[model samples]
Target: MFKMKEKWRYLKTEDKTAYANMAIDRAVLVANSECKVSPTVRFFTWNPPAISIGYFQSLEDEVNLEMCKNIGVDYVRRITGGGAVYHESELTYSIVIPESHPQVPKNIMESYGRICGAVIKGLKNLGINSNYIPVNDIIADGKKISGNAQTRKLKTVLQHGTILTDVDVNKMFLLLKVPDEKIKDKLIADVKQRVTSIKHILGDDINFNETAKAMKAGFEEEFNVDLVEGQLTSYEKELAKRFEIEFFGSKQWNHRR
Candidate 1:
């Protein structure tokens, strides 16, 4: 989609708490919207692991807070809308670019497919062929290996998603609420059948750094850009800090639904 300059910033994977991670994503979106930073592709992992619920989702309805607290898993609300996701043994990536950018499609579905193509290519680099399914999912070996969500704000678009390195369906189900207790087991089994991970597919674990490297190349190849390693700017850092304290880290904001 990009035909202009073939360059983008690569913010290598960083491990952080749920709040800090979300803050950085929002901060980057703001900075990119203002043209203060190059369009960025960043990767991150949730420290202590976490469950992030979608923007319109209710925390109480979607998550089991007592279970989360007991398991030492953190929780946060995402600016993007999607089902609650259990983040563990996974690589999460976010892309930030102005909505008016020449490469951005006016149609949402096309845009999702175009962006997710980068992920499909990344999975190919890992020797696991994958395809982008409409809406927002990547399937490998006929099972979902990644799920993505996107939102538009501040005249910019932000899309973030998880590529599973490993998966523990039982642990994930424990942290999420099922509408019916009786159907919980059935749901879990269904998910197990439908979702997959890199470890499961490759019969081994792929470290975060290695996965990030492959993903970085995926974006570079898809966009035909050179992904130069970089760090968050001073403005972005300060904004992230403020955003964490005021929004991502705030109970009122998280529970606002």
Candidate 2:
């Protein structure tokens, strides 16, 4: 009875660097708003792992540059504002839709609820019982497994989140600063208690493709739409390339805030 747009591009991409990852999201948002592309559901992963901070968060306060460089973890600042996320062993999804779409919620908070519910449904598809923690997070059995960030620009809404397949608390604490060594140990312990991953819950090293498939079904069931397999156009690819070189990868942009 509540049928809306059924056609949505499903772009399941390969693992990429932090720069390229951020770029693709921006490309989709811009292209869709300009009517150059259709609404899309993108799933991707990070190669070499990466740390992405919110647009408003301070890079210095949130991440340790030396640790990142020493450990070879890519880092960038996202256009969407939220907390930092360590993109490692995770399935990341990005949803791009026109702000004026009849089915899409107009209010920001309501929009987050709508989108995050789809993510919750996705986890359910994996047989992982998780609850939406509101504002922008999903917790599985009292431990967080997914975190999302969103932004609206050029009349388009872009919401992206990470469904962690595995979490390296030792590695994460190294990248994110706490305080003293004692605090660092306590922080790691606290994080281990708070954050969780699919691998941990399933008790196996489940492939990301498997998780991606579950996500597809989850969003489909939750949103009542089909995810038509699609590819990126030349325009978005070109823009992503430019963004990689100029925006995401550039120190000026990464350290600006």
What TM-score does structure 2 among the candidates reach?
0.96
lDDT for each residue of candidate 1 in 1-257, tens digit (9 for 90 to 100): 84675678889656799999999999999999889999999999989899999999999999999999998999999999988999989999999988887777868788899899999889889999999989999999999999999999998989999999999999999999999999998999999999999999999989999899899889988878888889999999999999999999999989996
Least lDDT summed over 10 consecutive residues: which range in candidate 2? 178-187
**Residues 44-159, candidate 2, lDDT per residue (tens digit)?**
99998899999999999889999999989999999999998888889999999999987689999888888998888888988899998878988998999999988999889999
Candidate 1 structure lDDT: 0.93
> Which candidate comes out best when scored by TM-score?
1
Candidate whose lDDT is highest = 1
Each model's lDDT comes to: 0.93, 0.90
Q: What's the residue-level lDDT of 166 in candidate 2?
A: 91
